[model samples]
Target: MDERSQFLADAAAQRKERELNRVQTETTLKLQALARGYLARKKFVSAVRSTTSEKFSAFVDLEKSEKVLLSNDEVLKWSRLFLRILRLPDDNEVLALLVPDTSYFHWTPSRVISDIISTIPQSLMYISGNRVTENSLFLASNEHKPLISGQALNALFSILFKSVKNDENLLPIFISHVLTCPAIVVHLNKANLDNFLNSELFDRCLTYLRSSPELVESIEPQKTINLLGNVIHLGYLDEETVKNRIVDWTWVIGLVMAQCTEFAVRPGEQSSHNHWHPIFGHYRLPIDPKLWKKLGGGSSSEPTHTAELEKDIPPTLAAIVCQLYMTALSTMTNMKNEIIAGICREDRTLRQLWSYLVRWGNQGRYVSSSSTAPSPLNAALSLMSCPQSLHAAPLMLFADAAAIVISILDEEELYERAVPFALEELVHIARFCNYFCFRAVWTGYVDDRSSDHGLFASIHQLCMVLHVRDSRRSFVNDPKFWLAPDVKSSILMGEFEKKTPRGVLLMRRMSHLVSLKERMLLFRKFVSADKNSNESSATLITGLDEAGIDQDGVFKEFLELTIKKVFDPALNLFHSTAAGVLYPSATSSVHEDHLALFQFVGRILAKAVYEGIVVDVQLAPVLLAAVRFFIQILLDFVVCN
Candidate 1:
């Protein structure tokens, strides 16, 4: 009883202490706010008073006030005062001073407001002049260029870009003010827009972004990207011209892709079970180990600090990155011409984009598996329902951008005009699609899913597109490139992992070792028994005669022999290419039982793949193309219904 009483008392004391700290913190904050407000108001009044020599007491009078007039110098002073005061911390009483209270001053508010708005672009022009003059010192004085000389217009971009690092909403505030100005709307023609884009300030900003990767999402780059987005939105340039300019300015896209690569690649080990989906429970398929290693994934040792760096990325920094990159992609992609071809002409850019896709596509698996992650349902729903929330969490946004570029890369005409994708790149993309699709299926099945179902749809579309294009193009049966055993294996099995029923089979000596027909019949009966059975979660095992247990060697031998015989020219089921790889016979449809024979052989091959057995058989690109068509058809049916 004494121990219980002591425990209750201690808990009560802790709660009282917490309450006291909360009240103290709140009180301190309120005092700080009051002090800041007083200081800002005093500064505004002093600056305003120094601008005029008239009896200001009469100007302050509500009833006895006459019209208060000001000279040009006085109005400029007031404008500068207002702009300076705007830089102070936000306070309602301070902001209220910007509007001339008619009863207090009897002055025209619209005239003053217009003056303040027009002074913004003038300030930017002044800065641009100074920067250009500084740059000209190293060159000939004859090379001097005049600054932007235009009618005064609202250009809050100067204020936005020059804002202190602590000011978070500067761009939004700038947009809000400038968007309401009639001059800005009327000045949306090409020449005026070009001045903004071609300004020395704009050029300097581009240089800064290209050179300083660490600060790519900082004030200057933010201003540059937003400036470009506005110009694009105004439709001042024709689509082709805009696309050409973007191609010339491809480094902006490069910056975005580089940042994405930094954010996506995590250090340390990747678990084999990272793809597990709770909705699908234990039925979720595991990734193939060989394929995982080929992608530069899976377990590895590294300095502990590398993992720490990933966690070090601030939410604010990541949010800025997502916004900037999305804006750039939206602007570039909106153009009618093929921008991706220009952007991905280099291998580095292509790899960066691919890395982005691989990382973000499976982010759901990461989020779901993480203990510190937000609730899967809440996170997924927020991303779908709120654009702002989605912006803050860039996982899906990164995937979507990468998908757009990749879909463009899939266009055959783009390759013909630009550079053909490297062979390994094609293989990697196909492999990733297959694995991504499988994981997507499990996510869709689970109620607490993580990944976007739209990604699955995109992959489905890509598959069909690639298949149709391949059907029209002649197969390049180059034997030298196809000779590497491992490369051929990855190409054939990497694109599609066929689903097969799992069960154990015990075969007598005569049927398993000798006759092809007998082996096929035996395997057919074994697979048929597993159709309605709940044995899919089990590993497939083959048993030989009583003297020898199959462990995996016997099964591998059986698979190799069965596949070789099935694809032989004597069987007339498939034809051999110059590369010595097998392709489905074009006239095989003439045989009544060809389809069934092919299906049976496919099932056996799938089982071999499921068990991680490497058979010597290689499939030609034409056959792989047909496989892609069927897989896409299956996915379309699954996703649609």
Candidate 2:
């Protein structure tokens, strides 16, 4: 019985092996047949090339001789088939026919020919037709899978690279037409894309792009900007490309800043509502597509100038530039010191930065979610009043990136250059701060504060700078604006300029940056006359005990008690770190009047600073750093939570 079983097994194994061999032989034969047919067509085309050229005055006439010339469908089919065959384990027969004896051709057709075929463009057109949505049928199609798979996609990029290499001017066309196509982009796996970006093909494209800004601007610059934005968004840039390849970081920064400022828009060119991208949300510019199209448009009598047209950045492009700038900031964070040194070492970039800030303050307008009540900071800073309210949300994308860059600049740099700029165009920094502060409170949630730390940290930095400077010397002799004399008008008109000390005036202006007008009154307690602040001292009155006048010891005791009560765990106002330093509780917004309490806590800290009292309480390590910008943490934490 064992011997019979062994014989059966041996027979079955031999049968299976023969079937595999037969299949392999058929595949090889099929490949050979395809190669032979392709070779014959190539030879026939070459033989008739001169005859066709002589007979036809135009290429269209030759195209009409369809049988002699490859059709678009045939080109695509043959290209895909050849690519598939090239990736097979044994394609020697196909290689022998296509490659010359002295020449070598690898995976891509670019290796075989100097020109790009119509297949790539045709495939891109087919793919782009579907618009690359989550529900896109093209993404799920099995028939198109081979064309977008690993080897095929690389070949397509290589074809593009070769075409652009043959003619550098073709770079813009490929960027706008080929790379932007959803079909081509959807196939690019991040891992593969990263490798391609590190290649000379990508380097060459970037070199040409950086060589002339006009080259990009002449075409649809937005398309080029979005392409770069997509690359940055993918986080494909490795340390090598970032450190060595990027020639002008300042130019890149300038390009983004240019897109964010305001431009001419006709009065009648209004949209029913402001548009937010369904995908990008509030992290981008709020201008809708209809409005974007109308931006540069004007009446026949009032023709738009080039200077005005330059400022009409498309809404999508504006959003992308914000995202692009933010991503670039994150990628280059490791080189923060280098950025600081660069800005400090050169005044040209510094001056540009200052100018951009001033322009944004003067021209840029944010869409607020609620009433269009002017921000007090706007009046204080002398920013242009924009009465239009077309969007349902506050625009913070530009403000967020600007805050990050400002935070990156060191205190010495800020003191030397930024301080002067801030003083000169008070509206610049005030408008910036107001944009950040006016964002609506994200209430009724337990959340991560990590994403918002950089922005709030920057505000804290600005606060520290203003506070320290004010303590050393007054900002100006006449701090108050004489226009609004009474307290009510001063607060209503956003002047807050009556008897307001410089530090107090700045602080009061910032406090008026709440989203709701009714909420502005909550800060009225802070809006008071410049009293004898030197003689001002706290007296802790204990029930059924003597009132203690705050001498140095009494003040220290009072501060310690106040801080302990404010940060008490049971109160749920603040959370303590491992080292007992206090930070705002992430879930504190669940409590009503949390914002008011935060304002109160801010006053207490300010008083402590005013009295030169160093409290025994420990604060968050970041807040207690060399630069002590600690104002925004409480409000931002509670409201943004």
Per-model CA lDDT versus the true structure? 0.42, 0.43
Model 1 worst lDDT window (10 residues): 501-510
Q: What TM-score does structure 2 among the candidates reach?
A: 0.34
- For every candidate in turn, the CA RMSD to the true structure comes to 25.4, 16.4
lDDT of 2 at 33: 100
Candidate 1 lDDT over 1-641, as tens digits, reads: 69999999999999999999999999999999999999999999767655542444335433455555455467668767877777556755654443223113243343343334444434443445334322321121111221221221212222223331123332233332232222243333344455445543333333444455455443232123333444334334344444444432344544443332222112232345444221111212343332223332211111111122134332333444444444434333333124434444564664555555445434543242355444323233323323233222344343443344543443343345332445445544444443433333333331223222333344534433443334334222322321212223333222222321111110110011123454454456546665537467677886654343455556567788998888887788987766576777778877799999999989998887555566778776445646744323222222222
Give the alpha carbon lDDT tens digit for every residue of 1-641 in model 2: 69999999999999999999999999999999999999999999766655644544343333364535566677778877877767554677654443332122322232223323423443444444224221222233213343334544445454444444445545555554554333344455564465556555455555555676554444332233345454343334444554555443323433432332222122344354523232221212353343134233111011112232124433233333333343343333334445445434543544454454444434435322234434433321221122111110012223332344444444455545653345545344543443433321112111133223333334434534343333233343334321122234345334333433322333333433322343444344333323434335788455543345644665667777987798797789887765566767878888899999988887888787655566666666444532344433322233223
Instruction: Give the number of the best model, judged by TM-score.
Output: 2
Q: Give me the displacement of residue 155 in model 1, in angstroms.
A: 13
Best lDDT among the predictions, by candidate number? 2
